[model samples]
Target: MSATDDVDRSSWLSGYSDTVEALPIELQRNFTLIRQLDDSAQELMDDVASKSLCLMNQKTVLSPKERQQRLANIGSLLNEVLKRGEEKFALAKSTYDTVDRHCTKLDMDLQKYEDEQLIGPTMGRPSTGTSTAGSDKRPEKEEHKRKKRKQTRGRKKGIAPEVDEGQQQGEYLSAEDAKQHAQSAISLSNLPIDPNEPLYCYCQQVSFGEMVACDNDECEIEWFHLECVGLRTPPKGKWYCKNCAELLKIKQKK
Candidate 1:
């Protein structure tokens, strides 16, 4: 047993077979560097789980700094919905150019009312009447010879032709003497001392019966039945009319 302990036990078994012959290569190279660091840590955990499931199926969920503040609030709501749709298409093209300039000024006012009703010389008259200007017709005898030379120069200037209601019925008065001469000229304008019987004159009874006169402009004033001025009932305190209470007492004595 002692040859030096059999040469130290064959040199320790030849240095343990040379350390088991370098372990496999070192264990493949450390297991290929730990399988390339586990495929880079599973590709950085699949890029952080696909950006956290794209911020949890988004609609608006965000967090990576709130998805950059929800992408800057969706780019300011698409620039305020494209500036309110370009201001409603420029106000619908300025209301279609103001309704095409009011339909070209109503087609030039309907062609000037059809050229003033076809230059009318009694245009198309037939209202069931006699009129050929009263008819002996040579253009109604030249329009009664130019209306008898303008009514003989308006009766040589005294101008009496406007006599309508059977010639102004003797100038005026006669609606029961113009309501008794407008109640004798509103009781001779002594203003309202009339305890119920004043004011006198206001006529116009059929054909030309007029007479009107009151504030003494030479006496003819008369016409009373506007229910005799209590104006058909309301009276209690503020009564008025007697020529507006004598012009409001001459405007409160001036």
Candidate 2:
């Protein structure tokens, strides 16, 4: 909600490779073609049925030569229907093959980008279904490793942590602190009772859903719920806690 990566979601999507955007549109066109083929085939079958009924009628007297000509017309119509169906089937197969190739490349590209993000100075921040590349969802573990800061027993006071110098957005965050935040970034829903504490965010609810971590090293309350700050979707890049965002704005205006 409040905290967002430097690059906005729209901007990131716009800059993606051509295939990423085009493949969806292309797939839709293919589906439409398939539907059209179905309708056309049904209409042709109705035409054949109507002609067959006419030939079967005994009330009308027909010369041998005329009867033979009617039979020929029916045979040609049936052949036409078969030809049309075969052509449509071939086109559909080709369309699916193209889609398969595009997806395979997209998978490789996303995997490489995700691997790169895990290294270097920004290492150890757990992503919560948010990234500019829009990679595949990270696999959910049946059980997440439980690691929490020591805290006193009770319903959390629902108090905001003290704002230190490091609480500023995109400011100093020690590597060790980043690692700690990443390790503790489990789904709030799965956070066990007693040892774990939830002292930050305006809602001040215990781990109940997906969470994102502020990069700030000294942030007393480092983790925040994605929903608490009004974010329907995760931020495109690095997300800071609400306090850090406000602090950053004040500093900017100054």
Candidate 3:
């Protein structure tokens, strides 16, 4: 090859220009989805922790309904966490399978190229590519199987790494299991909140400090935080959140 071609190839070998095509578009898209799902799941976990802390507050008095509401929120969060975990696992598994297929293809292609380049009178070069491809197929298949088993053999011999992680974290698949865990955790702290019931706010947070209640009785989530509404204090007269105001306007026109 020319000197320019040699220089370009040498640069690639030195890893100076390798990143541009390092990942395929499909893999990049999958990675983005994975990260988004992970961030959302982490936020849900934080919300669960924050709500749990609220339930543990000894000074704050919550009515039966309010307490039930908080518990119910935690339960919903636990269910969502499980759902996200399962989704991430499935997506990762699909990505793994795709990579496996690509690797096997790469192996076969390499064998063909090697057979072509090493051209000589080795049992006739016309059928050499076919012979090499055939010979490499069994080894490629066996290597794929070996790698799969090696990666997954740790957790009960066939479970994926993701499954092993979930098992290690106490197997909390639903709110019921979480509620039980909370019960055990609360016994020492003497927290009165059950891990089940439900609440009313756009933020899904415990009603605290200063909050404004919508005048409309029909409002699904009747409460709003002053900070959330961009107000320092409650409105002087009847205050309605944006949704409640729209509903009231509709009612007035009707």
Candidate 4:
């Protein structure tokens, strides 16, 4: 190899060694011990083979009893080596399993901490204004105005306002009435499913039940099962998924 190539290789090796050394002490020690054990095991096997060969080449003629004793000794030595190797493998596997469990627990705890921070009690606190009470009530008023504005816009566009089916269901209606109600409601054509997409819902893999399509024109998630969104029946009129609803809210604010 060229001198420059050798220098580059040396530098890479040095960096890799530093990275390994920066690992947790316990992990580094475990790796070091495993490497040493592997090397020792290899040397031992080599030594056993060499010694056995040397013994076989010896000119000393052995009786049947002596030959059997020699074979037994070699077998015992090999068995000991195998036992030691097995023990080392078991130890390494156990250490890895313990580390994996600890990592999983740490990840879960970190996620919980993040969630708590995001949804803290003070997150939506109103800023100071002329009066504390007025400021506190301002958010509720703004929310009401936003809903009214959305309804007004829907009416202007000749679209039926959204309604929660779960809340609006009245006393028993006949099947014929129900069918008529469904027909009168805005009809959303089924969006074509992608050829590569799975036919079943990712959340629950069963027959595709009553489905709803997002009203948003630009949403990539064309359709999802009503059950997947915790709805027994499709909502009346225009429907938007939670994500699309949030987006529309932001757009309105802007």
Residue 96 of model 4 has an lDDT of 71
Candidate 4: residue 177 Cα off by (Å) = 67
TM-score of 1: 0.21
Model 4, position 118: C-alpha lDDT score: 41
Tens-digit per-residue lDDT, 1-254, candidate 3: 35985786587545623432554776888888889889999999999999898789748788999889889989999899889888887777777677666566556656765664444334444566776776666668777875564344322222222321211211213556445534543452342222332344565554343555655557777665455555554554555678977877898999
> Candidate 2 residues 103-209, lDDT tens each?
66666666665565533323454764454233432332111211223121111423233343443222334666555544455444343333333365554556544
lDDT tens digits, residue span 106-131, model 1: 55655654444333434466743454
Model 2 ranges off by over 4 Å:
1-17, 117-254
Clashing pairs in 4: none
lDDT of each: 0.45, 0.58, 0.61, 0.59
Q: Could you tell me how far off, in angstroms, the CA of residue 235 lies in candidate 3 after the best superposition? A: 71
- Residue 66's lDDT in candidate 3: 87
Q: Which pairs of residues collide in candidate 3?
A: 68-197, 68-198, 69-198, 71-196, 72-196, 72-197
Clashes of 2: 2
For each candidate in turn, the TM-score is 0.21, 0.39, 0.38, 0.37
The candidate that achieves the highest TM-score relative to the unseen native structure? 2
Lowest lDDT 10-residue stretch of candidate 1: 206-215
What candidate 3 gets wrong by more than 4 Å, as runs, is 1-23, 58-60, 113-120, 123-254
| Top model number, lDDT | 3
Instruction: Compute the lDDT for candidate 2.
Output: 0.58
Q: Each model's RMSD to truth, in Å?
A: 49.8, 21.9, 26.2, 23.0
